[model samples]
Target: MAIFTENIGKVSVGKAVTWDRDAALLYALSIGAGRPDATEGIDYTTESSFGIQQKVFPTFAVVLGGSGGSMDHLGDFKLHQILHGGQSLVLHCELPPQGSVTPRSYMSAVYDQGKNAIIELTTELADPEGQLVATSVTSMVIRGETGYGPRPERAGSWAEPGSEPDAVIEQATSVDQALLYRLNGDRNPLHSDPVMASKAGFPRPVLHGLCTYGMAALALVRNSTLLAERGLGSINARFAAPVFPGQVLETRIWNTAAGALFQVLADGKIVLDRGVATAAAAVAQDAAELQDAAAN
Candidate 1:
């Protein structure tokens, strides 16, 4: 069956979600934080470290506030035919080590792209008190779903900065990176099963796009003291290609007046592009504040 465009604007019921210190720490390590050198990012990795207080990475909100939109309503389609096209996230405040929130997802839009259809979902997560914690917008491309109309065009383009990047941080994904990242809630076999990957036209299982996204976010925080102190107000990126596990990911960042423009490259090929990281208000410069985001 084809994507049900009629499902657009559908709203999902609120679903409660919670996470604790262990979940946060696991997310950090899955993205290769504090690896090889345990001392580098003790704040995110070790909860009971002498005097350091563990803090959650701002990107952790993505896992918590996933598109609660139900795919079953979108009509029948094979999972392997879908691709993670893009993602955008906005955080309202610093995530505590442990917290609970109810998330509701909306089927916002469905666009025809000639041979494929793009389905966008928007999710809002709020605390028990009804204060918004995070908002996430995710887009998925369904392959071979054709004949709706011409593709819609985004307004702007991502131009490579003329000057050199302000910062470049490289992180290596282990051979088991996908295996570990799957534990974070995404269990799509495309990242685990070779047979399923073949059905998706991949030589082998590829890394989760969101995993690479989270890695890029953490890299930015570790490379910039300003970002670490201020925290990230928002992050947006478009997936340009698939990144296989065991490959090295290099995040190139150009600091902008608004925040920063970034891209993630693997083996010299840009895998994530049109990236933007919005910096939150700067907090007081203190030891405690520094430790809170030491390894974001």
Candidate 2:
């Protein structure tokens, strides 16, 4: 509570980062995209599968700002009790297949619930050319750290999910899900160590929250009428429960004027709730993006 109040607007500038096609392909595979020996969609999991056809997955944007790891000064707080609350991503432009980027991250807001505290963070991702690519908003909730400060009003992510859904997509996670995802450079011991899991009050190491989010996002885009090349306009969702590796996730979706509404159920529990996704054609976005002219 004291730490978050002290750093409300402080910005953290990350060192330069560079990634290539192989990085993109591995990221795709980590999220359960097509496989190397896939009869179709081979370009996603295999960098050398196709020359010009290979493309980067839009969800890969989540990893651009250091695999969504801790920001510069966020280490000041006790992170062992921290849980990823939710994430919302707004894409300003298509992410490059191979490029260098530096991030500007800041503490946005803090919401003090009765039993937990929600710390909000926003990071701007920019290419070496200074072109803004994406904006990621993440919320981390620290459990058992409540009552230290006055309760702050909840914002953006507190909405509840609908009881009924228009559609549902079920996806199964591999037993080695966390192992594969860690290769993307987010080797957080909390997601990989059983000892760490026991210390954290879980039965075993849990799957990355973003891993579940990525699978849900993939289902949202693939099932929509929008073209895959166009991708999504905005994506948001809440993380409610821990998902173990090899669990089956059922993502329920509802089409709406804004785009879509969704919630994910795992092991008979809602793991991701209050979700929203929007889509727009790439040509329209590309033209509007060219008009902005803002650089990092």
Candidate 3:
């Protein structure tokens, strides 16, 4: 508890991050974006389409700031016992197809949850002019590292709507989905090495939580023009269960006046729940930005 609290609010050195059109396209394809049966979102997958201009997916912010892996400032903990508990992101504006940003990250809080502990991290991504681009909040659960005293305040139970879903979309994940997603910066062996997965008590390598979250966002944006017009203003969800590769994910969404509530199910079990997404106002793309994206 002492170590965790002491590190809170201490900003780490900023890291310069850059991405190109290829990276944006790869991120889109990794999240099951471009398919023959896809109704929309070709702009995300193709760089030089006729009338469509390529755009970055809002969920791509997860990789823009990179994972908070430099945890030595905090006390040592078992790596295998850690898992992504939840993820949230708020985009300040539409991300260009290619751009650069400097990510400033810091430990936000630590909550003790009986046999586990939840470490919260906040990262701010900014452009070269120091304008905020996106803010990300990540919760990491460390098993068997509890008893430090502070317990997180319980959030209200998420009740499912009684009416039928507004939309239900099923997407298939490729067997190499995790492998492809790892190229985005997360190289955790738990998502790749079968031996490491077994040691962590899993039958096999599991898909990245961010990947699953991105897929959920993909389903929503592809299905609803209202949400995809500009891009997602914000989105958040809790990781309830592990999603193995090659499994089909069914995302059920319930439309609300503000935005929507959603859940992702794998084989009838909820893998992501307590979801919320807000749509951003549609913005026209600038030709200069498009040309810059193409050049770099």
Candidate 4:
């Protein structure tokens, strides 16, 4: 069976998740908040600053408010043929340091691209007060499952950014990075189960794409040169390759008329490509912010 385009608008509720500060801190560290003895972002990765202030990384919304629904309603396709294509996040406001959020999601679009089917899922995350926290849009490519779903009625709704990056941020991924990242919510065996990894045709477990996304966004925000201008408005990327633990990630970005274009690489390999990040639109900030961001 191919992707069930008929179910495009069907909606569902994901299991609610009660988030806390400890978990938030763990998430911060997993994304390279406080690593290599860097004190710049200790506020995110450590609790020492909790006495003064409680902060949450904006990107945490992806996991904290992640849609926990099953996509079985779509169609039957081999799991091995599924690939994470891209992810984008839109934040309405900063999330609280700790709170419970339930994600309501729907299948937005299904595209038949000759050799594979593309599934687009959108999830809205709301706090207990029903206030929107963030929205996550994820696309998955289903191989060998094609010619059944209808082409998108809208054209050019989803397009890749331009070539070349204007800014590049490099960070090292720890060998145990995946171990800590999985604790954020996704306990998927594919990221930790050696047997499952091998069966999936990998020598070992692979890092989660979301983790790479967090790193990419944070990299841009952490860049002194970039932070000197504005904050991150939205982040988007396509998972181009698998990133093994202990790899150095280089997030290359280009300032665009629309926002920012980007791509990620590991050991000279393109891992996440066709990236885009919209700026917060000229947020006032002095050069001092750059000094602070560079501490990390």
Candidate 5:
């Protein structure tokens, strides 16, 4: 199948979507936040004042991508073959405990690799008063689903580190990470039912896509030196394999001028690769403004 050149510049902006406390809480739970032994504190899972102020789990931004858009319309490709390659989010400010938000999203770029395709999409979330809340970018890699034809002008592949990664972080998924994540409203039984999962070619229930997403986020937060210095501005990655619960994920980090390159590996195999996270420059600007205010 060939891509629709006419849809190259396609864009879609959606109405403001209000998120209540329930929604926020539910999203947190979806990423295994409430689990008894998860690294995140138990306050997030309980009803308390401190829980209300807890940082929103970063992976919750995935829900914001859906308003109205057809993947088929954008590319002459099979939706079934489309896999979420990677995702990244930057929080402009602390999200309010509860509030409404409007999200604007669009396809920023598409690269054809002859045998595969890379699609990049961006989404912006704003509050009712028109303040920007968060910005997210997602990259999808369609394997064996690329459009047939001549190759475009060549651009070099992003550089990967030649030396051993500077750091490695590992985490194991709970047996119920998928079941727990489904409470957030994604009812895909592939993560819940053993029979369904087997039918889908898994020996057991699989983890939720967002759970894998959260694991990736944890990798970024725990291992990146740049994020600690300036905060995460964005992340881009490609998902390469399905992760079953109870698998130990080892995330490796590589430093670069443009961003930090990372990968998520399971069972000694690379499951999520070509991962990148960029830090926010505005954090320094905001700090400077605060310093000036304090001096005044």
Candidate 6:
């Protein structure tokens, strides 16, 4: 295995990436928006007062400064065997309708867990003007790839659900989700061309994992009834299963003192298991004070 300790600092992966209207449209389509049968019925492409504006999906930050060949460099790691363990994003500002963005990525930390290795990466995106647009932190748990030496300490997992969720929100994907998402400049082919997918060991074209992540975010924003209350502060989730296009995703949420717990289920199976989001405490505090004043 490669020791990335020396690489755990500021690293530039790519130059300025142009963000345009087409990119925004594709991202919206990837997440099941703008479909003929969409439940939300929001036209993201058109200038509308409702629905998300022509903005890049928050989760796009993960791919921004990605090193094209990290897996190849890591010895003994079967790239196919590795999975995206979790994703989280913090938006510093609303994505502009169109602009150029430069991202700086770096290895934030590495945790050796005896049986597994947990790698953390962070990327910061800035507009041409040097204004911060967004920041993302991703954690990848390399299962069964550990024991190079003594283990390191890491944060504990989120508290497991002690009871059933309080509410469940369901959203179905359009059959063209993968195809549309690819237009967002991903061009991975794994999500579109069937031949490519088969080569990757998938039965058929699978939706971009990030597409599902965006859908889960939409579910959380809608279900928590906090879209207008709390600006999206943070979203963290694990991809439990591959969701093909045209599958219905059911997101279950539980309100907590810290934030909200969530899970995305498809066809009665948990696809995004063990998800959690932390909202800005400032909003929650303000809401509480309003409630107290009303009670008085």
Q: Name the best candidate (by lDDT).
A: 1
Candidate models: Cα lDDT each:
0.83, 0.76, 0.83, 0.78, 0.67, 0.68
Candidate numbers, best TM-score first, in rank order: 3, 1, 4, 2, 6, 5
Q: Compared with the true structure, what per-residue lDDT tens digits does model 5 show for residues 1-296?
A: 75565665566768667666677677766655554365454444444655345555555666754523556656666766666766666667766556777877777667765577767677788888888778776766767855544434522234677999988977777777777678766787877888988887789987765577676765665567776566565565667788888888888888665447888888998887777776666444555787899999
Task: Tell how far residue 167 is off in model 5, in angstroms.
Answer: 2.7
Measured with C-alpha atoms, the lDDT of residue 230 in candidate 2 is: 52
Q: Is candidate 2 or candidate 3 better by lDDT?
A: 3
**Clashing residue pairs, backbone N/CA/C < 3 A, model 4:** 166-253, 166-254
How well does candidate 1 score on lDDT at residue 146?
Answer: 74
Query: Which wins on lDDT, candidate 1 or candidate 2?
Result: 1
Q: Clash pairs of candidate 5?
A: 16-102, 17-101, 85-237, 85-238, 85-239, 86-237
Ranking by lDDT: 1, 3, 4, 2, 6, 5
Residue-wise C-alpha lDDT for candidate 4, range 1-296, written one tens digit per residue: 66777888788887777888898898889998886666776767766664556678878888864644677887787777888888888776777777888888998888777788888889988888888777888888898776655765731123554565566788899888899999998898999989999988899999999999998888877663544366665677788899989889988876664456678899999998877666554311322465689986
- Per-residue C-alpha lDDT of model 1 across residues 14-124, encoded as one tens digit per residue: 668999899999998898887767788778877998989998878888998566845888768887688789998878778889999998888777878767988888888
* RMSD to true structure for each model, in Å: 6.6, 4.2, 6.9, 7.4, 5.6, 6.1
**Tens digit per residue, CA lDDT, model 3, 1-296:** 33366788988856789999999999988998876455467888888878888989889988987755587776677566777899988787779999999998898878886678888889999999999898898988888777556955633224578898889999999899999999998898999999999988899999999999999998887665467454577788999999999999999988765466789999999999998877764112333455689999
**lDDT preference between candidates 3 and 5, better one:** 3
TM-score, every prediction: 0.86, 0.84, 0.87, 0.85, 0.76, 0.79
Q: Worst lDDT window (10 residues) for model 5?
A: 148-157
Higher-TM-score candidate among 5 and 6? 6
TM for candidate 5 is 0.76
TM-score between model 6 and native: 0.79
Error of 1 at 232 (Å): 1.1
